[model samples]
Target chain A: GAGVSQSPRYKVAKRGQDVALRCDPISGHVSLFWYQQALGQGPEFLTYFQNEAQLDKSGLPSDRFFAERPEGSVSTLKIQRTQQEDSAVYLCASSSQAFSYNEQFFGPGTRLTVL
Target chain B: TQLLEQSPQFLSIQEGENLTVYCNSSSVFSSLQWYRQEPGEGPVLLVTVVTGGEVKKLKRLTFQFGDARKDSSLHITAAQPGDTGLYLCAGGRSGGYNKLIFGAGTRLAVHP
Candidate 1:
């Protein structure tokens, strides 16, 4: 319960369809991150948010991927015109501080499947 | 791009045996962390080594960071079935965004 929580544990989207995944970080966490993990591969950074501001999004694959933490507490990752290559486990993690290398707590993640 | 490489992609050992996994890289890192991930679950951080040549122990698990900060290792003494999982090593740079670069991971299977 105190850990990060992700909505829609499983998602299936057809080609060219749009999908949105939501994440609720632990209460009062200042830093939140989104990662993409393909089968048999390690989790790769997607984007990071410090409060309401998105400081880095270099890991996002393409323009079709967008993430926002409007209120700084809850964030959403939206993928438009999804492709089969986009299928992966989307994970959300949160840490206490923005600068230090604090331990991150991850959620169960949303398994996205693009057909 | 800074890359972390883990060796012995897969290891299957009988219970009570000892095994070691390694993570190597060319670029120095500010900190290195080890995590264990089970099926259908997120990874759980086991330890973080910040200082170069640092060695940390968590129960039967031991972690070492290279003096150059470019590599690290994880050793399990007397592995057990519960220790079976995907072991990952991640590196954090000193400046700019402290984004973590993860290794490919070593899948360990401890059979009883």
Candidate 2:
């Protein structure tokens, strides 16, 4: 159980509702990443955090998507005014290295269903 | 946007069969990684190839990176039912960010 852990393995939200998915990376991991995986597709980068500092968020689908990591440990991805398009799985990953080309350990992911 | 195109989006074969999945792109990558994902679970890294024209083997799986680093392939020999899952290829940039550009993935099913 040393790998990354995500909360609310499954979430159901109505359109226009707000939802927050949490991610707890492995201890001592310096790099954390969030990705969105649509049904039948691979995961696409959503955002990245390096020890509480959010470095890159170019992959965020829209301005409604926001993520924050306080104290360099747990991360929370919040979707404001949820849309039906977000009805996919949100994945969290962590790595011990500073760079991304290194190995990253992923969690089971939080599957979100927006109605 | 850099895109990775995967071939044979869905593949089905009997046990003890061989198959190959490919990921191609026009943009060059600093490194390429292969991952296998099961239902409701996150992807697990299978292999990472940094050097162009490099080939790495893991058990019955063989991964090859293109000479131009713009493509890659995964070949499974004598696959078993346990091999059934979604195979994905991801391209990483050299900027030290973990933002990965991933292919759509190849869903493989090996029947017994």
Candidate 3:
């Protein structure tokens, strides 16, 4: 794809259920970011990956939230024991450069709904 | 806590009208970026200003960074309905970490 792509555009899960969202960043992008956005708010950073390395996960709300990028081109965010508050749009973005000066390309995002 | 605060959380205007959104913070940043996000889509980067007191223009949108690097403003000239979306401001400090802190965001609605 010419741009970042995410799978499972929308997901519905019952409370306490687990869900996984996938992200396919633009080819050759070395920097990938995951963010969670509640309705009517800005995105909150979840994690950051520099190629295959997961350098930061400070924004993950709890231990139940986990993310990984084995090959550096694709990433996944897994949430366990979901709660109502965990329901939000999960977005993934990729940048060509390793520094903040680079522009980021974002995916459409996966909207998770906890019933 | 929100590192950045955006004023006028919501704005509604008729097409062709002009408006401005503000992003403020107490901390200094090395660079600031603005992004616009549509419904069901992720935020798309609009502009990035590295130097304080810098001003950049993109078509009908004009962005200004504060001299102190603690604030910024986005001005739109003759906004159209297509301009309706959520605007976000993010700041990153130096030191190579490059983790961006985002503001609460401003939702703009332009009626045609």
Candidate 4:
């Protein structure tokens, strides 16, 4: 079975530009999550989706960050007016069920570098 | 905010040596998971411990959950070069949207 997958393995963007990172979750996965990983640090939660409904997004650092999982399968995390601080690896994960106890399958991640 | 603190942020050991990484938190969790990530790759789940005082072993790797469910540990016996990577421990609270709080991670480098 295919695991979660993210596009644009690496992206270099100028500050103030907008970037959208895409995620393809495994088929029939009911839970999806987004996380931000800074260098030398563990991944920080960003948002979550159960099907097409976004269940929680309190972890999003700022208003500049937004995400959507419309249609309940594919998701996207978009950053508006990117800042140098936004540079990090954006990871997407999915689990078969909506329960938090289930193990999440993670994607390779898209490294965004704001220059 | 629930924070998971991992000790020994960085570790370098020779192959065949044993090592242990610890994750501690002030808040209790319903479940804890250990993940291993190599360079340029997303973290791969290693083990999940839900019961207090629980121990699960994967080959030479052993995982333990604290009796209080507030801490966990991973011990590798006879480490190999393939064991080298960032080890992360994540805690999931009992309720909410199933958000996971992750530790800063311990970077392990095993030299053969």
**Candidate ranking (DockQ, best to worst):** 2, 4, 3, 1
Measured with C-alpha atoms, the lDDT of residue B38 in candidate 2 is: 94
Task: Report how far residue B108 has shifted in candidate 1, in Å.
Answer: 0.7
The runs of at least 3 residues in candidate 4 whose Cα sits more than 4 Å from the true structure, single-residue gaps closed, are none
Per-prediction DockQ scores? 0.66, 0.82, 0.71, 0.77
Q: Lowest-lDDT window of 10 residues in candidate 1 chain A?
A: A96-105
**Candidates' C-alpha lDDT:** 0.93, 0.94, 0.93, 0.94
Winning candidate number (DockQ): 2
lDDT of residue B41 for candidate 1: 85
> Residue by residue across B1-112, what tens digits does model 1's lDDT show?
4399998899999999999999999888899999999988888889999999999999999999999999999999999999999999999877644578899899999999
Residue-wise lDDT of candidate 3 within A1-115, one digit each (tens)?
A: 5999998999999999999999999999999999999888888899999999999999999999999999988999999999999999999999988876688888999999999
- Per-prediction TM-score, chain A only? 0.98, 0.97, 0.98, 0.98
lDDT of 2 by residue, A1-115 (tens): 8999999999999999999999999999999999999988899999989999999898899999999999999999999999999899999999997875789999999999999
Q: Supply candidate 2's per-residue lDDT for A18.
A: 99
- Each model's number of backbone clashes? 0, 0, 0, 0
Chain B alone: TM-score in each candidate? 0.95, 0.97, 0.98, 0.95
lDDT of 1 by residue, A47-80 (tens): 9999999999999999999999999999999999
Q: In model 3, which residue pairs have backbone atoms overlapping below 3 Å?
A: none
State the lDDT at B23 in candidate 1: 97
